[model samples]
Structures are given as C-alpha cells and as structure tokens.
Target chain A: MSVLLTPDQTAFLQGTLSMNVGAVGRDGWPCVCRAQGLVVARDRRSLTVLLSASRGRAVLESLDAGSAITLVASRPATHATLQLKAARAARVGVSAAHHAASARCVAAFGAELETLGYAAGLSATLAGVLPTDDLVALRFAPDIVFDQTPGPDAGRVLAHT
Target chain B: MNISLESLRPCLDGAIPAVVATASPDGTPNVAYASQVHYVDSEHVALSFQFFSKTRENVLAHPYAQVQVIEPKSFRHFRLKVHYLRTETSGPLFEYMKAQLAGIAARSGMAKVFALRGADVYRVLDIENVDPRLLPAPAPPDALLKLRRTFAHLGACDDLTRLADRALAALAHGFGIRHALLALLDETGGALYTLASLGYSASGVGAEVALGEGLIGVAAREAIPVRINYHTGDYTYHAALYVADPASPRIPLPVLADPHSQIAVPLTHGEYLVGVLYAESEENAFFSHADEDALVVYGRHLAALIVQLAALPDDAEPALAAPAPAPSGAPLAVRYFAHDHSVFVDNDYLIKGVAGSILWTLLNEHAASGRRDFCNRELRRDPRLPLPDFGDNLETRLILLARRLAERCPQIALEKTGRGRFRLELARPLQLNAG
Candidate 1:
C-alpha cells in the first residue's frame, strides 16, 4: 500500500527544508535539487512541482527520451524525508501550478515570514531572480515512496499504515 | 462592462432554430429540426436534438452534416459544415440542457415541452464558418488608443525580466507562435545576447550573435524586421541560431533543411534598436502582413517598457510601489483554478492546492458582488470533485497546507477577513530582474 500522508504529515513534508528532488538525465546521471513547493494531488496519490524549464526541461527531455526518473524529498533538518521514485506524467502550464503552490506556500509560511525583507528573499530564491517564459509545472506519478525519520519512534512513523 | 446572458440572448434573437441536414447512403437529403441552439459557454453555442432523427442516422452513416440556422423573420442564414464525432448524453451538459429547457418552457408558457426531455436530445454544434457580411465592420485601431491610455501601466513595469517575458507573451498570444526569443543588443549594438527565450532550453539563453550575423542581427543592424524562409534561404549566416525543439521536428541549426518561416522584429525605442524579438514556425509563410504589423506594434510597446525600466533610479525598488491600499474593506479580484489546483489574487498571487481554490472562490464572489465577506456556503460542490477536504477537519488541514506553501513562497498572505471570510492577498506584484 502507498504511504498516505495526513494533513499534518503533508504540511511537514512541504515545510521541511531537507526534502530533495532527484532527477535522472538522459545520460543516466542524476541531478538532485531542493523540491520547492511540492504539492500532493487531491487524491493523495501524486505529487507535483513547478520546475523552471531552464532546469527541469532537461529531465523532461530525458523522460521523453524514455529515461526513468526518481525524486526523493526529505527534511534533513528534522531527519524526516519522503523519497518517491516516479516517472514524469505530464507537463502543464506554469500558471496552473504556480497559483496553487504559491497559495499553499503563503498559507504555510505567510505568518512566520511576514517581514518585507523575508518576502524579498523568498521571491528572489523561489520565484527566481529572472523570469523566463517557459517555466512549466511537472506532474509526477510516484511508483514507490521511501520515508525515513530519526529515532526509534521514527521507524513507526515511517511504517506503512 | 459586464456582459450578461440577457445581452447575448439578443444576438440569437433573430437566429433560426438550426436544422441538421445529412445525405443518406442513397443520396437522399435527411433533415431534422435541431432545438439545441443555446450558448454553451460564454463564446460558443451548443445545439442538441434527438439522436435517432433521420439527420442523425444519416450523419452516423456519412460522418458529415450541414447545419443551418436562419434569422426567423429576415431569412438571412448561418450554416455550419461539421463532422460529427460522438454524442455525450449525461453529465453537466445534460443537466445544463435540462435547466435551459425548463427556462425556455417557462418563458414560452409551454412547461410541458420539457416533459419529453429524454426524447428531445441535444446536438453539439461546431461552427465551421460564418458569412463574412454578417460580421461587424472593422473597429478603429484601439491598440494606439489603449497604448495612449495605458502608457503609465507599461511605464510602471520596473523589471527587465518581466518586460521581456511580457513582450514575448504578447508575441506568442497575439501572433500564435509556438516559441519566441528576445535577444537584447549589447551596449555597442554590435552583438545580441539571449536575455530570455520561450520554448527553448536554458543552454540557448545567453548565447550571442554578432552584429550582421543572423536574422536577429540583421534586424538589429538595419533597425527593421527581417522575414526569412528557412527552407530555401542561404543559411551560411544563420546556422547557429537557437530554435525550440519541442515546437517541431526541424532543428534550429542547418536552417536550410526544410522550408520554415521566421520573423525578426527589432525592439526599438524611437531610433535605438534595443533588442530583437524573433519568432519561427516550421510551416511555410506562417506569418501575414497583419501579423507583422501587430509585432511591430508589440515591439514598440516593449521598447517603451525597456526605456521606462532603464530610466528608473538604480536604488529604487524593483516593483511598482503599491498604490495606497483600496480602503481596508475593498473587495479583491480573485480567480480560482480548481482543476489545476491553484488560485490567483488579482491574477497575480498564484497559490497552489485546494486552499487556494477556497480562498479564490470566496474572494471572487465577494469582489464581484462588491461585498466584504463570504463563507463556505458551497464547499466541494463541484461535481468534478477536484478538491479533497476531510470534512470538519478542513480548517486545521487548510492551515497546515497554507504553512507548507508559505515555506517556499512567502509573498502571499492568507488572512481572516471577517468572521467566516478569508482573504488571500499578494504583498507585492512579482518582480523579474533581467540580470
């Protein structure tokens, strides 16, 4: 059975700083980056990320060339991670996913980082210092998920229900 | 101005009830009166009639049908030469037709007409063509008019990256190009540096072309738009130009492989050619004179944006200063994208997930009504069920979801507006830096 994340778990997975996304290139090399504003599908079975075409296009092209991809997201600071091995399902318009991810991100961190300086920093890093027209939304269907949290109790938490 | 169904009803007032006409296997004309002539969405109309009609039977046999709807009194007509695909009998469309039939019956004092609903079917209408004379006369050039009125709006954009993106968006949206590239001329106007490109790889951006090198360079050097046909052209100078791969099978290199169309519009401010907006398509003669005119207009607007950005003080904030908040209680414009799982505030603050949808619908309703508040009166009411809420745990879950989104995107604010209403607002418009 697939590991189902509760609302709290989902939130933790999203806000956790250590969750990394690994993508495989056509040459079989894996490129790993921090998963920004990763969102779970409404059905709780899929996760999506808004990837700039500049960076994510390579992975998409690789997938189009029939290369399988694995995305591992983890909160290293808390020693909690959700690693999902999946293939690219589709690429949609950035506007479609950005709005959702932005809203969720705002709600998730809006109160804690209300300062203008923080907003500027967030915008600079997350929205990119420059805007490109081909920024796209990548939807991935996870074939397998691996979760690891620290401590003896972490094992139970990572255990499939 | 708000366009309502009432206003649209007048357009169809004189339109005749369409008749589906098809040829039988024996070449006999089979015709059936179609009552399914109603607005589908805001722009298109849907027509539904009985599937078992002679015309439907003939259409199934032939896959081709001509539908005619004439002005009731004038006999002036509209015809649609359509190829029938399939029939959808259930779902939202069926319910929509049911409600429409009910309204029609009520208005015509024939409520019994809806009683035979199942037998009275609906046919999907696809408009193939419209009589040219039926269309209204060409409107005056509103581009220049809008530019005059909204020059300040363009002037307000302070970021070069955004200006570039917007310029390309205008080109793609207006000209229907699969991809676009904006390469700014270096300070000396000698070489072109790819500042940003749509539908091309990252490696393509920042690439350079010397003055008088390729199409873009020629356009920049001459300060004129360069139109090229790649298939038969002497590509000795255009071999290294970057072309978007996903758009077509043709490669950007080896420009002489197959016949392709390309247009390069130099971005100019008065006399200075600041950049080149290049667009291409694999098909022959992809662009027209009218398209070139639009691109020139767009190029002018983009030049204006660049000049304004260049004129801004170096120390000034990168985004437009917020015009004082619209009173504390002013409603905000919001758009909800449930299928895509996102919400936009004033079409700017794009937030992800169901929380965005909730906030979007609430704010949109309140804004449209000039009201200050709304509640969860219709939660998860969409039949498509794109959102998943765990019943009473909605608030808590949403709060968590909001926090997750905030971690990456901190500019958006979701706050309680009143007792039951929530407002999602952008702290500032997104700023895109060119460097």
Candidate 2:
C-alpha cells in the first residue's frame, strides 16, 4: 500500500521551509545537508528534492547507494516537522517550471525563519542557495511517513490513506 | 587549532540538535540528527539512542562516527570524531541523561514519547573547530575565574546569612546570572523553605515548597541538577503531571513571567542534603552547559559552608526575656486557616503553614505568659505548633515570620535579637482566632 500525503502534509511540503535529507551510503558513513529544489509530486505518491552539485557530494553519494533515507521538512516558526522514510531514490534533471518553484520555496522558508525569531537577513543566509551547475533532483518513493513534529506524535508512523 | 571534546561542551548541550555521521565496516557512510550529545568527559560523549536504527547499526558494526554540534548562544560549530563505546542502559550517566531528556521532552511536548532506549557512550578520537574565526571570544560568565573567586569569598563567611549572601553575589558576578534563590532544606526532610532570594519582587522570604513537588523538589529529591529552556510553555502544568500536587501555593515561588530558562541544583554534603540553589531568567537559554558545570563546582563550596555552620554552636543568648511592654491599640484579630495553615492578620495576608502556626503559637504564648522572647530550641520543641518530622526550619521560619510580620502586620512584629532567638514587638494587643 502506498501512503498518500495528507492535506496537512501536502501543505507542509509546499510551504516555505528548509528541507533536510539524511542517508547512509554503502560504505556506511552517514551524511545530511540542506536540501533545496523541493517538489511534492501532484499525486503525493513520491517527492522530488534537489541537492546542489557543489555542496551535496556526500548527500548525492548516499542517494546513489540506494539505501533507505529520511527527508525532513520543517517550519522554523512552530517547529512542526514531517519525516518521510523513502526506500528508493533516482537522479533527475531540473525542469524550468520546477526551477522557479525552488526560488519561491526559499523565500517562503526564509519568512518562516524570521517568524521563528531569526534576524531579518538570517533566513536568506540559512536557506542553501541552489547551485547553477549539476543541480540534480532526487525522485524517491516514500515507503512510510512519520510525523516528526517536536512532540509525542514525532516519528509516529502515519497510515497510508 | 584542535580542541578537546570537553572544551566544546556548550555546543553539545542539545539546545541546537546535532548531526551525526557514521560509517559501516564496509565503508558505507550514514548521517542522522541527534537530540543531544551529552558530555561524559573530556574524552567521551553520550549520544541518545532512541530509534535511529541505521545510525545505531552503523555505529555498533563500524565503531567510527562523527558528530557536528553548534553552540546555541554563539553559532560556532565543532565536529567531533568519535569511536563507539559500550551502551549503558542504567547508571548515573544514564539516569542523568534520562532526567535531562525528560526536561527536553517535556518542553517539546514529547514527554510521552522519545523514550530513552540507551545512552550510547562514545570515546572522542579528535575534535576540529569547523570555523576558526579570529575574533575575541564571547564572555562565558567567566565560570572558572568566578568559581575560584566565589570559593575564596565563601571561605570568609562566618555565618549562614553571610555565606548565603556571598553565594548569590558570586553567581551574579561570575555566571552573569541575574536572578537566583537559595533555599535551605527544612528538617521535615520533605520541604524547602526560602532563605535568601535575588531578582524577585518580594524576597519570597517565607515561601515553602514540599519535597518531590516542583522543579526544586525534583532536584532535591534526586540530588541532581535540572535545567530547561523553553520559548513558551506554562510551568504550571507541572502540578497536572503529579496527581496530588498541592494547589499552587498561595505565596507563589518567585519566577519570571514566561520563564524561558530555569535551573535547580541540589546542594548536599556527604549524605545530608544541605539546600538547593535555583536560578531563572526571562532571556531564552539564559544558562548554558558551562554555567551548569560552574555551579555544580561552586555548589560544593556551599554544601561545606551549610554543614559547617549547622554544626557550629549557637552564639546568641537564650530567649525567655520579657519583651518591651506592648503598646496600646485595638485588639488585632489573627486568623489561622487550619486547612492550609495560612495566616491573616486583621484580614491582611501574612505567612502560612508551619510559619503561620509558629506566629500564632508565639502570640498564644505571649497572651498567656506575657513573654515575648523565643528561641529556636523552644519553637522546635513546641507541641502546639505541628512541625514536620525533623523539621529544622525553625531559625528560617523565625526569619520568615519576622519578615512577614514586619511587612504586613506592623502592629505585632518579631525581630531577631541574636542567633536562634527573637523578641516579639507588639504595637497592639492581638486576639488569636483558630480557623
């Protein structure tokens, strides 16, 4: 059974917030970096996130290992978080339409950071700017979704609706 | 420049979640976030193993790991190369981490979840300062220097009062702590009474909190330190956590509105619990890991002073002296709320509990024998007032009663004439009513 993203989860993914991805490669060294160029597929069956070519080397290697990984998208204002446990990942080219969404995502996430008590310019700084070259999108099918909000429901496995 | 793991402690306190990376035996690398990287020693740190299956598997199988931690106050980051050690399910470190996790969990509304499976202790192999900004270091409350200075000044205190004042002054100057309170453990073995407090509207001079009650109680009960940082969370919910928690004390313990940070350190000498040192602030994350470390060291100095002073002989003359004649006035009515032992003088609220009973008892004795002077020994032995088992808060109760009387009920007052002895100065005759 494939779990579809709930309306709330869909809203979270589309909202302005920095996304982080975690993975362990075949060699077993774990790595994580700020993920940009986030896109939730229209059907909510999968997610596509882009890692910069220049800064996401370890992250790309982890994805290349094809090991299970976690994608966490969180709003800084309320610490509300959602974790996606993805089983498979593949690299894809960035589309022009999706490229514009990436800029909008950073701007929105920056607004959330400001609401969370960050200084005026910190949001822009904390949001990792997408690199121009080798900006690869990771298309992964989420096996399970976990509510990663900073509370009891955090990490709770959500049923596929 | 290289750094010892301990020097990077402030960064590891878990305020800012740390990211950990580990490689499998086959050289496959993994990365995940950790809630806290607890400092075990200069050579080790304990990472919480809750449910990160991959990270756990990698560490157990490979032994090599790296964690990147950021200092919350100053956003400096440090990377620690560590090797996996044994996992501890139970012990001092585990329990301490459990308490800390509880605070963090409770603050984040995850107290019901985030179970502590084990404390995975890791031996630090190397530490690297990720950024070597050549800037003047931020002042850290000068913990080491202030601790040394506090110890020297504490050594000069000849009495408990002086010792307490010096302790508060030391924390203020050394730790940059703005608000602090020192409460001596009552003889009842179950309550702590306010003796000295700074940074409150009222000194909360005579306020009392039972053992195992609130933050103060938890620290005293476990003989451990409890610290928390919250942007917004009502501490009042603590009572709901405990079924039989007494209704919020009428005289509320001094605390800031929306207290962003709080800490309570238990003071003990050998097996005897001396008192508790509590500090709070309106600023978020006001106290850091280094502050906790500094205070724990200075707490030893306080424990020694408290024990030494308690063992020292009383220097004041015995009480039983007839007080100056009572000035004439309308008979003021003293009402005692037996339910909570709250006392009100002529409808004006005064002290309560053992403190209230003590005042009522003193006035009772005055009406009967015309004697105004009383001593700690007499109050401790008084049968009319119910002091809890081993309740040695007499001297402090007298201090509370005297201060309350002096503040609210000016007509009838109690003043300390010497150590353990005080004279009741009655400006108006009083009628005691038992409620």
Candidate 3:
C-alpha cells in the first residue's frame, strides 16, 4: 500500500531538525547513521538525504538490490518523529541545491538542539565535523509514510488519497 | 590490538544512539535504528525486544551482527561485532531494561507503545574504534576526583548517621550536586521511607514512597538505575497527585516540580533491595555519564557500608542525663491525626506514618510520666506505634523522628543520649491532641 506525506510533514523534512537514514544490505542486514543534510523534494513525493561518505558506507552499498530505506526525521525540541520507508531507492551525486538544503538543515538542527536545552557551542561544534566534502544524495520516492511521533499512532500510515 | 569492553564504556553508555545491522542467510540485510544498546557488562549488551518483526527474523537466521555507536562530545565512532545470545524473558536485567525503556518511552511520548517483551543479550566478539582518536579525551578532573573523595568519605563512617552525613556531603561538596536523597526500603510497608536529603527547603525526611510508584520506588523495585536525561511530564511525581491516587494515599511525597534531569539508582546488598539513591538537577542533562558512573561506584560502596552498619549490635547508652526543666513558655500544641497518623505542631505539618506515630508516642510519654529518656528497645516494644517486621527499623525510625522533630517542630527535640538511646527535650509545655 502506498502512502503520502502530509504538507506539515513535507515542511518538517525540509526543516532543520535531526535526520537519519536506514538502509538494508544485499544480505538483508541494516545500516543507519546521522545524515549531513536532508531535502524533501519540491513535489513532496520524494526526499534527498545527503549521506556522509565517511560514516554511511553500508547504507551507500545497500542502495542497489532495491534494498528498503527508512528515513527517520525528528525534532529535538519536541521529540516529534516521522519515519518514511521507501523500496524504490537510488543514489546520485549531490547537487548544488542539495548542498544548500543540507547546509540549511544542519544549521537549523543545531539551533533546535540548543533551544531544547543542550549547551551553546554544541551545535556549531557538531556541524564542523558533520559536513562532508563529497556527498551522494540518496533520493527515494516514498511508498510508505508513518507518523512515528513517539505515541500510539507513531507507526500509523498516512494513507494515499 | 583487541579492545576490551571496559575501554569501550564511553561508547556503550548510550548517551548517543546506535545502529544495528543484520544480514539474512539469503544475503539480504536489515537495519534498525535503536535508541540505546544496554550495556549488561563488559562482554555483554542487551537490546530491547519490542515487537521485533524483521530484525528478529533476520537475527535468528544470521546470528552475527554489527552495531555502530557515536560519542556525543567527540563525534568518534566505534563498531562492535556481536553474536546473538539467548533472550532474557525475566530477571534483574529484564526488569532493569524494562524500567529504563519505560522512562525513555515516557520522555519520547511513547510510554504505552514501547513495551518490553524480552531483552536480547549479545556477546561482544570484538570492538573496533573506527574513527582515530583525536587528542585522547581526558576524564573530567571533577568526576574522577569527586568519586574518589566521595568513596573515601563514605568508607570512613562507622555508623549509619555519620555515613548518611558523609554521603550527602560528598554529593553536595565533592560532586557539586544540589539536590539528592537517600531512602531505605521498608519491607513491611512495601515502600521506601526518606531518611536523608540535601538541597530541599524541607528535608522531607520520613516521607513514605510506595514501592513501584515513583522514580525512586520503581528503581528499587527493578533494582536498576533509572536515568532520565530530559525531564518530562509523565514521570514527574507530584505530591498532590499521589494523595488522590488510591494506590498511594498515605501522603504525597515531595519532588522538584519539574526536574530537568533525574537519575535513581537502586542500592542492593546481595539479593536484598536495600534502598534507592536519587539525584536531580534543574539543568537539562545535568547528570553526565561520568556522574552516573561515579554515583554507581559510590552507591555500591554505600550499600556495603550500610549492610555492615546494619549488622552491628545496638550501642550502649551513656548514663541518663538529668532532664532539664521545661522552659517558661506557652504550651506547644501537638495535634495527632489518627486517620493518616499525621502530626502537626502549632498547626504546621511535621510528618506522618510511622514517624508521626513515633512522635506522638514520645510526646505522650513525656507529658504523663515526665520521662525524657527513651531507648530503641522500649520503642520497639511500644504497642501503639504500629511496629512492623519485629522493629527492624527501630533505630532508623528514631533517627528519622529525631531529624523531623529537629527540622520542623523545634519546640520539641530528641537528642541522642547513647548509641541507641535518645532523650526527649521539650523547649515549652506540651499539649498533646490525639485523634
């Protein structure tokens, strides 16, 4: 069954909170890590997560074989969570726009963590090491969208119209 | 070079999240993001088994797995090669993981959904530091130094009173903790009664918290350390809420309105649940992994010390000191509520439960017979004080009563005259109101 992302969720994906990508290997094992950047496609039908080359090796290798990808985006201040699963996945070179979006996301994420009571200088310090020089954008069209907001309806799907 | 699990503690503490990857026998892999990987010991770690759909199946088929962990401050990553061990359905570890998960779920607003079915224990086959160490991070000067000082202070105490004093002092002076408490288990009441505290306007001594009710109670029940980094509404145990709740209608125990960070560690002596040690701070994530680590070490020492002190025989009292004449003043009105065993002095709430009952009995004896000297042996034999478990807590109760009377009802005080004997000192005339 296909699902769609709500408008609010689309904005959330494009927001500055923390983002993570989980992908299964060819042998059905999973690899996940913090993403350097995330951008919800303008169409709101797909997402572009800039995977860090140094840390996301397994995720990058699992891009083929149509290995499933689950993107968990969360707001640090509110603990608001959204998990997106996609079977149709591919990795492409990071575009100029992807870099801009990724930059915006990291900047906002650090701010969010700060606002949520983490000490100052933490966000900036984290951002310095997170920005990857070379990146690959793992873009996937969403086949399943779950509420995952840490409650009863967390895993409930957003059914497609 | 092979690294032991002890060296990887900074990674296993779970301040940061972890990722688990498992491959199927058919060469297909699955990945699941986990909130934390519980470090059971040096060679073992347990993962929460909560409605495991894919990871379970994949792990069953392919037992070998890899976990990636990140250091919060350093951004350093470590990988662990682990082999799946048997799942624990029940035991101290399961209960510990279950309680910890409840707190995590509550903070994340998933309290009801994130239930623990079993704890999946894994044997660490190897630990690899993926990211090269950058200027090896030194242990915080305060944590290491403070833990040593705290342990030393606790080790030197020969009695429970001095032990408690040094423990609280270490928390405040050595560890720089503003708020902390030590409550011992009341097996008879199935509760933990507060005996000592620091950084509260009121010591809240003698306050009763039922087992499995609040953070401290749950920690004692599970016999595990419950650490909450960020405060949430779900776990906040308000005094007023408990008064209305049927489970614990005795008295509402006091805790900080909204403690940003709280950690409660259970004190155990062998198989017995001795008590719980709780500390909180207004600052978010106030307690670091180091703080928890230090406190854990201190708690173990404190528990052993407590057991040793408990095993000692009662002390001999000094010759009874002559009771001084009452000061010239108005009679102090001591109102006793039989319904809840709450005592009020001059209409001010003093204490309730066993402590309250103990106070009323003390005052009654002083008013009738003019007897000021009391001993632990007699209080244990008192028929009206609702003694439980063969007076196992007589001296502690006296200590609690003495402390409460000292803090709240200054008109009346109980000064220790001997090892297990105390002389009731009245500053003014006493008018006892019994319900």
TM-score of each: 0.27, 0.74, 0.80
What does the interface RMSD come to for each candidate? 31.4, 4.9, 3.7
DockQ of 3: 0.28
Q: How many backbone clashes does candidate 1 have?
A: 32
Task: Decide which is better by TM-score, 2 or 3.
Answer: 3
DockQ of each: 0.01, 0.22, 0.28
Give one digit per residue, the lDDT tens place, for model 1 in B1-435.
133322233233212234444555544333334544554444444455433444456666766655545432222234444555555465444443443343333332333433223322223334332222343223323344333443333345445545654555554544556666777665434566555566544324434566666566667766766554223233432426533222322213322233356677888888877778877777644654345556777777787676665444333222233233544433344455555445454445334334444545544444455443333334445433234442222332234334433543445455543322345555443322111
**If the candidates were sorted by their DockQ against the true structure, best first, what order would they fall in?**
3, 2, 1
Per-residue lDDT for B287 in model 1? 54
lDDT of each residue in B1-435, candidate 2, tens digit only: 267766777676556667777655655444556766898887889998777566788887888777877664344556677888899997557656765665555555556656678999998877765435423236666567767766665568766656656778777766667888887777567777777788878776666667766667777777887776543343432311321225734555665655667778888788788878988877766777777877877776688777776456554657556637647868888888887677887787787777888887888888899887777777777787777545365655666666667667778777766666678888887888988
Candidate 3 chain B least-lDDT 10 residues: B236-245
Each candidate's lDDT (Cα)? 0.46, 0.69, 0.71
lDDT of 3 by residue, B20-45 (tens): 76656655444455655888887898
Of the pair 1 and 3, which is ahead by TM-score? 3
